[model samples]
Target: MIEPQPTRRRPAADVQHAVERMRELARALPARDGIAVFNRVYLTVTEEVVRRSADGLFRDPLASAELSARFAERYLSAVEVAAGGHRPPACWRPLFQLRRHPGVRPLQFALAGINAHIGHDLALSVVDTCTARGCEPAEVEGDFERVGQVLTALEERIREDLMPGPDLLDIADPLTHLLGAWSLERARDAAWAAARVLWRLRDLPEVYGEFIEGVDSSVGMVGRCLLTPLG
Candidate 1:
């Protein structure tokens, strides 16, 4: 029989607290575990953001921190839902579902998590940040871009470090083709576009709600494909 999953409360409002939560989760799981792999990547990004924020690197520090926290909360919330034995958002479905699949490589786990977060959660977080701060998306766009830059850098390193060795580069290699089909740059662009659309649709709650659902489902579909286990 399946065990019941616990639903944890959302992370605290403080960015530091969120960082700690991520750190704790990363530490609690095995280093090579799929979810732990992604958590470690995210934890690195969060630490960098915290460091940059402390150095006053962001134009809107408050917005940046709030955005970061809200964004992390979404990911955590999805984990909580899954832990509670409930379904998470479509975008998150892949990671939680395949997290323990031995055939699913760590790189796949990391990339799929990044895909789900940036493709779906980031856009919503942008709008959430705007609503909480009573400001426009444009105002927090810099913070969003900054975080994207960090993710982009880490993504490059992830590919370099986790990608299978040169022997796997054959034209028929499914990993190559699968990884090639998804680009961080393209996903980031789509996320930014979606964020703008969501902000514009803010006044139309019904329309906005529907749009969110569409984005989540579409991104989730891509994530599911990305997590397809390679025999």
Candidate 2:
């Protein structure tokens, strides 16, 4: 007969104290440092949302709606930075390229595919929000057109500079194949779809807030995970 192993005791107090320390660190972070924190949070939250959504978190229509709304908020946040008016944190470039890493590439491609599929849904959400609030379609479309141009340029630059070269051509080929399999023409399709949704949902402040909060929370979590680990 084998001796029984001791069960691990829970350390709730230690966990709570650790959390408090993390919060303090987050609070003390400078704005530049905060960007990396937020980006990490965004990535974590989005990945969780994607996983959960696929695992039937969206079985409830309301939860599904909330997830979609959150996605829109996160995408818009990134788009805002890409629009040239605001500079996104430097970490964004590397974080975005993390998708290309061998360990994380599959998930990155999945996100790219999802982005392509849901881009219109996001755009429509925005459009709907604006219209309900008395904004004209033309105005929303104009803003989207301008923003879309900037985003396109940014994506192109990323592909050229960060995406792997011919040595990694095999990986690129498979990715391209996967994109075709998914019937996605490009990642830009997702951006376009999001703009369409925004036009449609521009006036639903409550929905918008839910979306924004999800993103904010996600960002917070990511920051804590990435930065606190360093500390």
Candidate 3:
């Protein structure tokens, strides 16, 4: 006779608990504080992406040292902006120079995609709440649509920038393993960091309701997509 097998643990229970906690947090937030909270969260996520990319890109001894230095400076400036301030000395100019470097282009494209997604989310959330509250719906819709268009354009630009040429596969082969692992880790951390920042916005009364409602609605939509029975 065979010995009884140990039962397998279900991870879904943990996920469900996390989701429930998120819903509770969403419900606890007040209405007016959403936009600021979202902006801060979005900025935090973007800054993390930039920081990780900078670190990874600079680790290449063969890469442009000046470019890395400029990127670090720009990243710091962006961090300042994220901290409720302006970019020092126009850091975006130096940051844009990364696009010119073949080695740095892939990371730039990835960061652009991440920023576009964040902007799209923020714009749509604003539009959703404005419409829900019967406040300047048409203007908000137009702005939201424009933001979506901009996001689409940025996505296309990034795709074109990142398209590998004939020699790219060979050049990338050496660093592929390391870059892949780092990018995945960074993306995961960025997403969670963003979520935590948004969660903290629950304390700010002015943006709290909108943030909670927007997040709750987003979560609900995701849940519906996941929980719907296969047709």
Candidate 4:
């Protein structure tokens, strides 16, 4: 009798497939739609993660892959929850709620989603990854920081690519200032801090859950502000 082989999870490969699926979906949607804009940004980030993972650039490839997958899962789950007619986290509520509003520009939509994901989802995802692997955040902090760097670099590109023409860079463009107020670096730092706090409170499930919920809702409020339409 042949021995049964243990199953392995290819986290990077899974992200690649998910990115491709999202890319196709974005292509099928109207370009100006808010969700499509964020989808494009997210797809680009996933592609970069997959590429870097393939090059063995991470300090711990397995942990990196797991962390990335867990991070992406949070975003995807929010989508499913909203699609099922249930509200997602407060951070996510803004994007899903205003995703189709004519007054909200694509740039606002993209940035709002980035704000929510980085501020709330990333921290929880860190906790989830640590729980799954029975390890400490310090063990995977390198991967987390590297991923943050990638997102920060990509965020610059997003601003340049999506911002209105040079003539509109003045105060007349409320979107410019609104997006500028949120920084990926700040969000990343806060996320790490939140992760540590959550981990410390983990033994108290009720407290841990409430902390996570508070983070989620507070981040959502910021997202709502970011997505506020400028007419």
Candidate 5:
């Protein structure tokens, strides 16, 4: 049975809380578990955001913290939904469905998770942050951009570290072809565009519902493609 979500949406407690949540999740999952792979990637980025915020990196630390926490909450919430034996959103189903498939590489799991999060969760998170802060999406754009920069930088490191060497996966491998098809920059750009669209549709609840359904299914489709295994 699916557990009901809270009626009122709230900002996650804070960025450190998000860090702790991901940490606990990582500890619970097996070392090479696909979800764990993605969890570690996200946790590292959250920890960095905490470090940079302490160093006074963001223009508005408090708002940035809230934004980051809110973003993490979406992923965490999806985890909870699945943990309770209910289906997660369409955007999240591919990773959960394929997490244990031995044929799929860790890098594939990690990227598929990112595809779902960045492609779907991100735009919703922007709207989530704006609503929680009682501001418009435009007002919240700075923090969003800063968080994106943090994610973009960490993603490069993740790719370098997680990618198999050419000896293991040759240039002609299907994995190589799959990797070439997706771009983090393009996903981020599309997310920003979706965020603005969602913001505009906020008043029309039915329209917003239909629009996000498309985003969820489309992102999930890409995630499925990312998880396809090859020899």
Candidate 6:
């Protein structure tokens, strides 16, 4: 008998294909499913990236797409792992763990998902792009920043769509404070810092492993806090 080859997510390697996968999730999952909420948010972001790329907005659209595609694969992989009955990476665990809790607001789910993806997946994605493109992280810094700008732009919209109005939630609310404590701009800066460090330590397997593990755990902790029930 012939041995079978292992399966791979061919879509994860392409921006358009990745968007399709996200769409698949959006269609299949419940509208209120925590994962579904995040999936919808991510889908909108990815679509915006594609639109901007097509509009000739990015300085290096190819590199931007490549980086975005790689960045998406990490989250998509985690979803696949969860679907396969295995725990995802530590960075993604908290979101999956508390996804359906009644007391956890949609905003919490959205932000927690963003926290996990931006905090951990993003740094590794930068490294992934560098490796695949035969370039340093600095070479792709422009693409990184431009893509991040898109997220930052959409973030306000995400809040408007998901966050309860002042009549519902207030500054005194723990959720508001939690949201205030985390900033996408800050997360982008930290992820860039981690990526530079990751690239430099790539030659040192042991040290790189430890550093990545630390990042994963630390980000996961923040994600868990973000997902905490408001009640």
Better of 1 and 5 by lDDT: 5
- The TM-score-based order of candidates, best leading, equals 6, 4, 5, 1, 2, 3
Q: Candidate 5 lDDT, tens digit per residue, 1-231?
A: 999986743333567777888999998999778899999998998898888888878876767777788788899999999999999999999999988898999889889999998999989888887887788888767767777788888877888788777345577788878878999889988999999999999999999999999999999999999999764
Each candidate: what lDDT? Answer: 0.84, 0.40, 0.35, 0.85, 0.86, 0.88
Structural similarity to truth (TM-score) of each candidate: 0.89, 0.34, 0.26, 0.92, 0.91, 0.92
- How accurate locally is residue 164 in candidate 2, as Cα lDDT from 0 to 100? 42
Write candidate 2's Cα lDDT for 47-158 as tens digits. 4444444565433423233323433454445535644656433323333333323343322333342342243334444454454445554444443443344344444333
Q: Supply candidate 4's per-residue lDDT for 130.
A: 94
- Estimate the overall C-alpha local distance difference test score of candidate 6: 0.88
Candidate 3's residue-wise lDDT over 103-174, tens digit each? 443333344324323322333333334433445434333333333343344444433444445334444453
Off by over 4 Å in 1: 1-13, 165-171
Residues forming the 10-long window of minimal summed lDDT in candidate 6: 5-14
Clashing pairs in 1: 5-83, 5-84
Error of 5 at 83 (Å): 1.1
Best by TM-score: 6
Q: Report the Cα RMSD per candidate.
A: 6.4, 19.0, 22.7, 3.0, 4.3, 3.1
In the range 13-61, model 4's lDDT, one tens digit per residue, is 7576677678776778788878788888988898898788888778988
Residue lDDT tens for model 6, 1-231 = 999987744332488788889999999988878899999999999999888888887887777888888888889999999999999989899889888888999999998899899999999999988897799888888878888888889988888899766455666788778878999999999999999999999999999999999999999999988988886
Q: Which stretches of candidate 2 lie over 4 Å from their true place?
A: 1-103, 106-121, 128-133, 165-168, 179-231
Model 3, residue 90: C-alpha shift (Å): 22
Clashing pairs in 6: none
